[model samples]
Target: MPSKSSSHSWHVFTATQDPHHHHHHHDQLSYELPYTMEICMTELDPVLAGKFFRRSGDEKSGHSAGKEMTELTGINEINKEAFICDFAFDPCGYSMNGMDGELYSTIHVTPEDGYSYASFECAGLVNNDDDDDIVHVLRKVVQIFRPGTMSVSITTCSEYNNEVWRKVAGAVEPLGMKCRSCAVDQFPAIGSVVFQTFTPLRWKNASK
Candidate 1:
């Protein structure tokens, strides 16, 4: 993460509409606290840069191959997990085993509440379907971390094409959060998309 001081030209736009309209069109738009994160160009590893597009067994490197879905969505007492070692990679060069094969990133979810955290990991496997699991897990964290705040930011500085960033935007933006990019210089060949969001002040009534 780049220091907040390292100034770089940032392009701000809404993934949906400008200043999300509240219900009744009368509810005042909440003030969004300012926060920024820097995504370094080096942060994107080769495995995540689309290297494991659609290869069968995890041949790229000796590690885990295929997708696994763990039930982190605490609700009904049900545990479900699946792997796609037999399936071939999809046309997009990712796992064809639904969204599980498409996700290529990881996020550590430590909810504000006492919930055993979980890690979502994928080596080079890139696809669109992976968003739900990622977002679902992150959303839960956001609720636990800053319940009053309705926004969150996913920061990365990995070397990736615009398509990867757009996919990230598509996954995160809908969850009522703003997406931001860092390390613009890294993706000179391809434009970088950065987003901004606010973290609610937990001590709104307390003195500074």
Candidate 2:
């Protein structure tokens, strides 16, 4: 039986630090201005997981398989400048990393029956004026796994905008998952964190 613990989750965080601070004069100056988003999915649909398998005689290389999935999922089009490095595992699994200048995106999958799981993560500038980009990306990620349950966490500086989560919820709920809980907290000087949980309508009905 598939574990009920299986679920998907997302986390996004943004922060800025002074590169020239005297306290860290010896440290290299590195800063990530873009927000980060992580989405995890578990208890994957067997039919969908089958798509990640590599056939015989095919190049037995992870990079090749990763590249194939990247192209198949249209991830390459997400950022024109993004350079991808991917891998495929024996039996069934895939992983990829996308680099676009300073920003990065990564994906990993485990299609096994007992512990099926997948994750998609990316870093990019936040556009408060429009969230369509994120919504589109997330929609695609969810489509890939069609998970039964999911959770999302967003972290950003104290001044971080709250509208992003609303948009995230909006993007996910339409796919049959409904938000069940939302929690907010602070991380001292780091930023604020918001964690939300969701479950598919069918799952909720089953539990009831």
Candidate 3:
């Protein structure tokens, strides 16, 4: 049985008030530029998740093995424009950071038994409903590591009240997921955060 919400067990990543914001007059810093902070944490499918596992006799260094995984798993394709720096843990795990111009994205993987977990973060803006950067990247990340249960959150320093927040669920649901819970919170300083949890539709139905 599976189900989903703000059940944020782990903070994949978060925003911080820049120390350089020496304006003590204000409690929080303002987003001078409009961009979305998109993050996703997923329990990877057990069988497919084994890709991050180390082979029994393979003597490849963690760095070497991780490099292989990055290439083998199609991570390089996620952002052709970004330069990627990736690494693999001693036994089993993967991490990557990509930079494209001023924007950046990161991915971390933890192969915990059948509960292989992966999280991703990207900085981009949802320009229009037609085609945008963040959504496209999110979709590619999802395809790379299909999750049995997934939770996603998006925050923007722009007018995303009815815009980017809704787009989070809309973009992922078509991928065989059912939104279990959604929570909205006003950013302490400015902007808004939309958090949603999900489980595979198949699992949702099974639970019922």
Candidate 4:
């Protein structure tokens, strides 16, 4: 078992509207970006996972629990303009959805023995300068779950390039994880996809 590990995957797809349709009505302006990220993790620390559990006898709704977790996890701090909707599962789990202007982000946690898992996903418009934002978000997520292993998938139009994966690797490696492998491929007309895997340094040493 790797002490810390991660992977990233990317995809690209066509846009339904003209690329120059930014002048459309605000409501018609979907926040859908040219890319998407699906990051997954496992082997979460029990102490950190426990934070997802609702207090005993507390009958708050899932939305309420989500709000509390979001605040506690500093998800609210990521983008103050984003409207958040969240839910808390019984015993130990949490999920949240956030929309900031046109961007969307979501998080889910399943902290159970034998099947511990968590995921973070988001979509937004990005320019060359947005790499720092990815780093910040990725780091915050790792802090939340402290997973021993993780995988990240990024889907984006071919025109967008693949620099984001390097930033992703930079964000998590300092936390004691190391990148083990990276694979890239094109999805026909969809675009390009990149998959990167990471493992904890401790695990690497043990395997040797």
The C-alpha stretches of model 1 lying farther than 4 A from their native spots are: 1-119, 127-160, 184-208
- Ranked by lDDT, the better of candidates 3 and 4 is 4
TM-score of each: 0.29, 0.77, 0.78, 0.79
Each candidate's lDDT (Cα)?
0.31, 0.68, 0.69, 0.72
Regions of model 2 farther than 4 Å from truth: 1-33, 77-80
Please rank every candidate by TM-score, starting with the best. Answer: 4, 3, 2, 1
Residues 15-77 of candidate 3 have per-residue lDDT tens digits of 567523322232344423346555555678666567777788888877788778888888888
Top candidate (lDDT): 4
In angstroms, the error of model 4 at 51 is 0.4
lDDT of 4 by residue, 1-208 (tens): 1212223443444554444433222243333335677778888878887778788988888788778878876778766778888888876689888998778998888988667889889875654545656677778878888888777767666645467668778989998877776666655444666667666789889989
Give the per-residue lDDT digits (tens) of candidate 1, residues 4-113: 32342344343434343332212334421111222211112232323323345445322232232112222111112323231223321222221234333333322222
With candidate 2 superimposed using the best TM-score fit, by how many Å does residue 161's alpha carbon deviate from the native? 4.3
Best by TM-score: 4
Q: Of the pair 2 and 4, which is ahead by TM-score? A: 4
Q: Name the Cα RMSD for model 2.
A: 7.0
Clash totals, every prediction: 15, 4, 0, 22
Candidate 4, residue 91: lDDT? 67
The lowest-lDDT stretch of 10 consecutive residues in candidate 3 is 19-28
Candidate 2 residues 164-191, lDDT tens each? 5687789988988777776666554445
